[model samples]
Target: MEDYLEKIYELMHEKGYARVSDIASSLDVQPSSVTKMLQKLDENHYVTYEKYRGILLTARGQRLGKLMKERHHMLEEFLRMLGVSEETIHKDVEGIEHHVSPHTLQCLQALVLFFDDHPESLNDLHAYTEQFEMGSPTDTEGKSV
Candidate 1:
């Protein structure tokens, strides 16, 4: 499953090899579930699963996993820029990354790049957000009252 692939990718990044127990713990699932998913992944050629040994991703699997991780990071960064909290970013990104299209992701990447080159814009945006949070009323035409 996609969750398995994501966990394997994360574990591989954190630690070299991904043990079944590690994967189970990361996903908060039982080892039996991890074993079953590993078997399926092995059959699909995404990973090499031994009975007791750890799993290793194949070249194709690794590439796909890396891409997913990158997209997750991009989503997190984009959400942070929108004033989403760090705690919320992890949950929000996890939920949206799989559903967002490549075109949307590209747009988000472009926005990130644009802000990176123009940090002042972020400050202005933050000030505007603060104005709304401070209970400043806006007129019908959308101008601050």
Candidate 2:
């Protein structure tokens, strides 16, 4: 359900249409998988599909997809700010965004906006992380007993 919605969102962003082949290729799944999911989404009123054509997200579906994409983008930006590697951000955000609570998402969004407004704050993050040893429980100021 969410997977199909997310795939459709990605396909729409990449191309104008949500073709079965496009969704399958993007998800690395079979065309049969995409067809089955599309049928379900159509039944659920999330999309409109026609045989041999492609699927179009309904207004509800489009809104949901856009929200999910925003969350993913926010999580990716937050992870990057934490010094996570670019190579890992895509997969990491994919896994984490779905499970993160709304409060966490809002916090992440705020952090992204904050850093965007103050790029120098990133240097502070680096310094804060460097202050803590691997197993230490020191405070933010890095003072250890």
Scored by lDDT, the top model is 1
Per residue, candidate 1 scores C-alpha lDDT tens digits across 46-92 of 89889976789998779778888888778888889889998888899
Q: After superposition, how far is residue 132 of candidate 2 from its true place, in Å?
A: 2.8
Candidate 2 clashes between residue pairs 3 or more apart in a chain or in different chains: none
Least lDDT summed over 10 consecutive residues: which range in candidate 1? 136-145
Decoy 2 TM-score against native: 0.85
* Alpha carbon deviation, residue 7, candidate 2 (Å): 2.6
Cα lDDT tens digits, model 2, 11-118, are 888877788887888888999988888888899888998879778999989988888887877888798889889999999987897788899889889889999999
Question: TM-score of each candidate?
Answer: 0.85, 0.85
